[model samples]
Target: MNWILLIIAGLFEVGFATCLGKAKENSGNNAIMWYLGFLFCLTISMVLLVKVSKELPIGTAYAVWTGIGAVGSVVVGIFVFKEPATFWRVFFLSTLILSIVGLKFVSK
Candidate 1:
């Protein structure tokens, strides 16, 4: 289904973001590899988003896709990058999730 594809695309967005962060953390050959990974994932994410947008409303598709990416990226930052886990951060992320779900339900 288109929604499933959109979800996958959102995941790819997370992948690309992770790759981008990793790229900056590496050096020389590792850096190049990470950069390539970032590019590959970013391209795939964009393609999938375009496909989903073709069948779904552009605003809804973009919002949900970016919402998933934002939430996933923040979680990764906490776990992988050892970022702070403030209560307000978690609260806002939860709010974003609710909004994404609401958009899905209201969307055609």
Candidate 2:
């Protein structure tokens, strides 16, 4: 389904973003490696975005895709990267999730 592809694409968005953070921690060849990984995942994300765009409304698809990426990246940041888990941050993330779900239900 297009929605499924959209979800996968969003996940890859999170993947590339995480790679970007990792790249920032390194230098020289190591950083280049991470950057390359980021680019690869980013390409996949964009490809899927374009694929789903043919079926779904671009505005809805893009908003959901980015919502997924934003929430996923924040979760990875808190858990994998040990970023702060402030209450307000979690609260806002919940709202974002709700909005994504609402979009899905309302989508034709």
lDDT of 2 by residue, 1-108 (tens): 999999999999999999999999899999999999999999999999999999999999999999999999999999988999999999999999999999999999
Worst-scoring 10-residue span by lDDT in model 2 = 17-26
- Write down the worst ten-residue block by lDDT for model 1: 34-43
For residue 106, what is the lDDT in candidate 2?
98
TM-score for candidate 1: 0.98
C-alpha positional error of residue 22 in candidate 1 after TM-score superposition, expressed in Å: 0.8
Q: How do the residues 1-108 of candidate 1 rate in per-residue lDDT, one tens digit apiece?
A: 999999999998999899889989999999999889988989999999999999999999999999999999999999999999999999999999999999999999
Deviation in Å, model 2, residue 63 alpha carbon: 0.3
Report the number of the highest-lDDT candidate. Answer: 2
For each candidate, what is the lDDT?
A: 0.94, 0.97
